[model samples]
Target: MFATATRNFVDEVDRGGLLIPVRSLNDSIALLTVVVSQKGFWFWQKPKHVPTDFTLNDILTGDIPITPVLSETDFIKYNGIYGDSIQGSMDATFIHSNMNAAGKDSSKLELSFGSLKKDEVDVRQLLRDTKNSVLDMSHSLIKQTQKKRQVFGLVKERIVTSQPCSVTEEVQQADQCGGTLGFCGPKSPKVSLKDNGSLSKDSNVTMEIPTNTTIAYALIDLEVKHDGHYELCLMSNKGGFEVDSRTQKGLLGVTGAVSNNPDDVSRLAQELKDLSDHFQLLSALPASSKASLLKIVTDVTEDRAALGALQSVLNRMLVEKSANIADVSEAHKQSIQPVLEMLKESECGSVAETECSASLLSALHLITSALDELTHESLSALRACRSPAVLKITQLLVHCLCESGESPASATNVGVLSEDVLANLEHLFTSSDVNLQRDGDAATIQIKQLQKPGNRPLIMFIALRGLHSLAQGV
Candidate 1:
């Protein structure tokens, strides 16, 4: 019954002109019959009458005749012989085996009849081995996929951690850049003493100043002392002074002052004392004094009364040994030093001009007379003054004495007979016949007596002419 059905199916395929020859169809049916009968006998339950001796070798050796029912013309009409197609399908199986072997191992297989026979090939066993290899390869591929997933997860975690670190670093860099641009920073307070002689007790005094602001000028009023315990403090974000603080106390102590040098303080004290004495003497003098002297005193005293007040405050602080007293004195000196320099420049060449020489000389003489009556302290201060005004006066007086060949004994006591005053006198007379020397509290000038009796009259005449010119200017 099976043979008859298979023959009928082949005949139908040939009649339909499917290009499948009956012989090749019969060979395929015989091979399928062999595999089903041998491997799947339980499923079919083969009848006793059906043949069970079929094999692939019997079919290949032509022990089973597979006659083509279709004519050659019919086969050509469908599409040439279909035997090539069957042969190509068989070649594909060998090609698949070669590819699998290449991937599985390095050993080469010779494609020869002897090698094939010598191997005693088993088709079922080969198929089973190939299936097991495929299963093992699939299992290994699944494990490799899982490992890749773990590595990807680690890389993602690292990236997540690194992002915040990079952001933090960027924020720090931005803050530094802002500082350079002068933004977002604390500023120092500018403290000024109030009229009530007290600083505001607020610790964080915020001045409307920008960061890194510089001081243009600082005006400190030391006139009002609080019970002889005056204290001034400056506070700032960067750094500033704090009164009565440990740091400040350390700096103001005796050892601290000595270490910091007190020469500048001493010099400033001397200057202030000299100015105070001069003002005091002038203030004591009656307003009915000489016009030129009164004018000079009024002009300086009216415009500079603050200096005198500051001087008094400084003297008290020095005597009491106040903290940072030198610092206060130095500040005052800096404020007044420029004015003194200007005065010195103004006084130079003041009496050199023939037009204003006499008036300038008279004004200088009045100053000299005032200086001469000053106390020892005042005298010391005046001696320290190196203004050209004082020196020029000495020069003019000496010049007059030389021209007249007469000693004005009254002028010799016009100022303190200090070394500086005597030096000026000597300098003025160095090129003249007059010889100057300090005599007790006065400077004496003596005319040289030349030995040429015949030239004495000529010398007298020149002296008279100089005196006449000076008198005319007066």
Candidate 2:
């Protein structure tokens, strides 16, 4: 359904900039190219009524008079939040109701060829999304800090144990005999959890033992080196598991999906819609139907609906990616011919002046951050980043702030690196790290930092080189 939907839409658009509507998914956008084949369209303006002389091809091809498709069709009704898919044609009156006031009256043609083109990521946002998701998982997999819990027990005095705990949505029971499903015994005191994509972050971002706490957790830690090597370490912690096994029971207690809440199948449908995937079709629907449809999209954990929705999101991302690629390829670099010439100057500004300058530094940091955002994961926006040029353009835009000879008032301050202070400006960087702990001044880093000078405004600079060094190879 995913591949076929794109192919069908692509065949209709050929290679045009217009976004057509489909009754298939919520708030969906389909394109119809000016193709080699031209035929009459079929469209209905009113209930069970066809245009006087209209053919199906005419409606599909947008050849019908604007009156019927716009005002006459139910698709154009201005009700907010939801409605049914109008007749085949876009309610010309409601080309994009989801848009803001500025874009409310804008037609699909306007959206396709509008100022939003810059939003396109040539390397394919979808691919970037995927990559970031993996990194997030990697980061999440990194073992969270499990501090030793101190307690006075009847059997042991002041027992300091590595309290084992797991975050989960629900748990199940084991069907076999001689097994407790939700909770576990001393021998099997580890809980297994699904990788809630969000789980990969600050292992400290924890959930209290909500509802279920009968099961144990199988503690595992994943470490990622700067070189990209990942090591997984598994161990049996000293403390018994802290878990909620209320839903499942057994020696090998059954459990519902543990996490990845954001992209939880239940949540993915809305996310897909946000990204203008097939879920966009829901936009044309009435508020209630749209809600029901979204419910169907989310409540899909083990069924074909889940698989179908996932496939649609992925496929739409790829198509949008390909489309973005074509866009970057066609952009005219010559449009800014003069600026290009300036960059070719024999002697450009000094690296520090250009990179760390009060004006240009923020831009540099922003672009770098954006690059990290782009490079973090392909799943982030497979539809947006389709080509290398896209990321290059993003870099260009970031550097463009500096190249323009005018400093932006607000620049990103990514504080200097500890290592940089260690090497070039040593005592200043680690003074607090080493001596503060010794001196019992844990607040030293706050006292001293990457501050720019007011007298010599031009000399104002953050130790970004420190950050760069720290992030090197990482």
On lDDT, the leading prediction is: 1
TM-score of 2: 0.14
What lDDT does the true structure give each of the candidates?
0.25, 0.20
Q: TM-scores across all candidates?
A: 0.15, 0.14
Model 1 misplacement above 4 A? 1-389, 392-396, 399-404, 414-417, 431-433, 449-474
lDDT of 1 by residue, 1-474 (tens): 112121222333332221111111122222212211011111111101112233222322223343212111111111111100000000011111211100000111111101000101233332343231211112332234222221000000000010111000000000011101110101212222222231111121111212111111011111111122222121211111113344543211110001121112232234323334323333332222222232233223211222332333332333333323243345455433332332223232333543332333333323322322222222222222223233334444544454454445555453543354455335434323345555565555554444311211222222222222221211
Compute the lDDT for candidate 2: 0.20
Model 1 lDDT-worst window of ten: 151-160
Worst 10 residues of 2 by lDDT: 151-160
Compared with the true structure, the alpha-carbon lDDT of candidate 1 equals 0.25
lDDT of 2 by residue, 268-357 (tens): 223222323211222332333222222222222112223233323222223232211122112222111211222222122343433222
